[model samples]
Target: MAILKQYKKSDGTTAWFYKLYMGKDPITGKERRTTRRGFKTKKEACLDLARLQLEIESKGLNNNSVRTYRELYNLWMSQHTLNIRNTTEQRVRNYFTNQILPSF
Candidate 1:
């Protein structure tokens, strides 16, 4: 289930509201809040809430795990440069050693 709430905006000219759902983090198993936008009209609010409800029902609400920099870089290299020739490999290695590794 999700939390439905409403409030007045800072300017007091408009009303803001939102629907918040609790989801567990996939990697950590920690509870996290997912909120949909607030709108002036009740229809708009309901529409946002319905969209979120659909997403939660279909996808389940776990955040995907993050990949470390090294992991990402290696994956990128494999996809982008692993097919290159030996000369290109040498150039890439030189660039990694002189530019990328030092900076990172």
Candidate 2:
């Protein structure tokens, strides 16, 4: 869904804006939103919305798969260990799990 809006700017200039709902994030299942402003005409906003919708339909709502950070970390670790040595892999994995995955 998208809505066009008209508002007064801080400089007292009228502008056109649009808020486009980009659907839920696959990883978090939260609603995604995007807004663009400063369009001089509604036609520009409409055209941009059309382009965005096409891209969303072609690609996806969100690329992530609703996996938790731990799940994603394990998935990435599996791929990362494919060509690496066992010792180095363990060190790297430890670093990520301790210093990085927790943040996510």
Among residues 3 or more apart in sequence or in different chains, the pairs in candidate 1 whose N, CA or C atoms overlap within 3 Å are: none
Among all windows of ten consecutive residues in candidate 1, which has the lowest summed lDDT?
Answer: 62-71
- lDDT string for model 1 (1-104, tens) is 65556677667756546647556767688887766644877677777778877877787776344366666666667777758888887798788768887787
- The regions of model 2 sitting more than 4 angstroms off are 63-104
Question: Number of clashes in model 2?
Answer: 0
Clashes of each: 0, 0
lDDT (0 to 1) per candidate: 0.70, 0.86
Q: What are the per-residue Cα lDDT tens digits for candidate 2 across 1-104?
A: 89998889899988899999898888788999999899878888888889988998998986657468888778878888998999999899889978997787
Give per-model TM-scores: 0.53, 0.56
Q: Which sections of candidate 1 miss by over 4 Å?
A: 63-98, 101-104
